[model samples]
Target: MELDCTAVIADVWLMLDGECDESTRARLQHHMDTCSPCIEAYGIEEKIKGLLSRKCGGDRAPDSLRDRLTLEIRKSVTVTRIETTEA
Candidate 1:
C-alpha cells in the first residue's frame, strides 16, 4: 500500500507516544525510511514531544487546555486525512 505523507506526519505523535499498533508503527517507520519529508517532519515532531515531556514530565494539563489541544489535533488529523485522500 502507498503511504500518505500528510497522514504519516499527522500520526508522528502517535508513533512517538507508542499509541499506534505495531503494524501501524512499522508502516510509518518504513515510510520514514524512504521518505525524506516525512522523516524530517517526524524528527521535528519528536523534538517537540521530547521538549513537552521534559517540561511537563509529571504535570497534567488543565482539563480545558487538554480538551482544546485534543480538539485541535483531531481537526488537524481530519484535515490532513481529507487532503491526502483527495490528492
Candidate 2:
C-alpha cells in the first residue's frame, strides 16, 4: 500500500512516542526514508521532543501554572460533556 503525506503526518507523533504498531511504524519509516520533506520534518520533531524531554526532566510546573492548566482541562471536559449530551 502507498502512503500519502497526510497519513504519514498523522502517525508521525505516534511513531515518535513509541505508541504506534510495528506495521504503522515501519510504513512511516519507509516513507521517511524515501521522502525528503517528511524526513526533515521528522528530524525536527524528534529534536524538539528530545529537547523538551531533557528540559522537563528536572523541572516542575509552578503551582499557578499547574492550577491554570487544571482549570482549563476541567473546563474543556465539562464543555465537551455538555456538547455530547446535547448531541
Candidate 3:
C-alpha cells in the first residue's frame, strides 16, 4: 500500500509530541526510514521545536505580565457579557 504523505504530515505534530500510539509511531518511522524528503522535513521540525523550547524555557513570561494579561482578559469578558446582554 502506498503511504499517505498527507495523512502523515497532518499527524506529524502528534508523532513529534510522542502522543501517537505504537502502531502509528511504527508507521511514521517506517515512512521516515524510506523517505528522504520526510526525514528532512522531520529534521527541520525537530530543530524548530528545539529552538522554540530553548527560547521559551525560562523567565520568558514575567509574573506581572501574566497578571496583567489575566486582568485584561477578565475585563474583556465582562465587557463582552454586558454587550451581549444589552443586545
Clash tally, candidates in order: 0, 0, 0
Which window of 10 residues has the lowest lDDT sum in candidate 3? 1-10
lDDT of 2 by residue, 9-82 (tens): 55565788787899989999999899997788788879987898898895766979856865665566567657
**Over the stretch 1-87, how does candidate 3's per-residue lDDT look in tens digits?**
556555555456567868789998999989888888778877887887688778888545676985685566556656765787799
Compute each candidate's TM-score over C-alphas.
0.73, 0.62, 0.60
TM-score quality measure for candidate 1: 0.73
lDDT of each: 0.83, 0.75, 0.71
Minimal lDDT window, size 10, model 2: 69-78
Please name the candidate that would achieve the greatest lDDT relative to the true structure.
1
Residue 12, candidate 1: C-alpha displacement in angstroms: 0.6
Q: Rank candidates by lDDT, best first.
A: 1, 2, 3
Question: Stretches of candidate 2 above 4 Å error?
Answer: 58-87
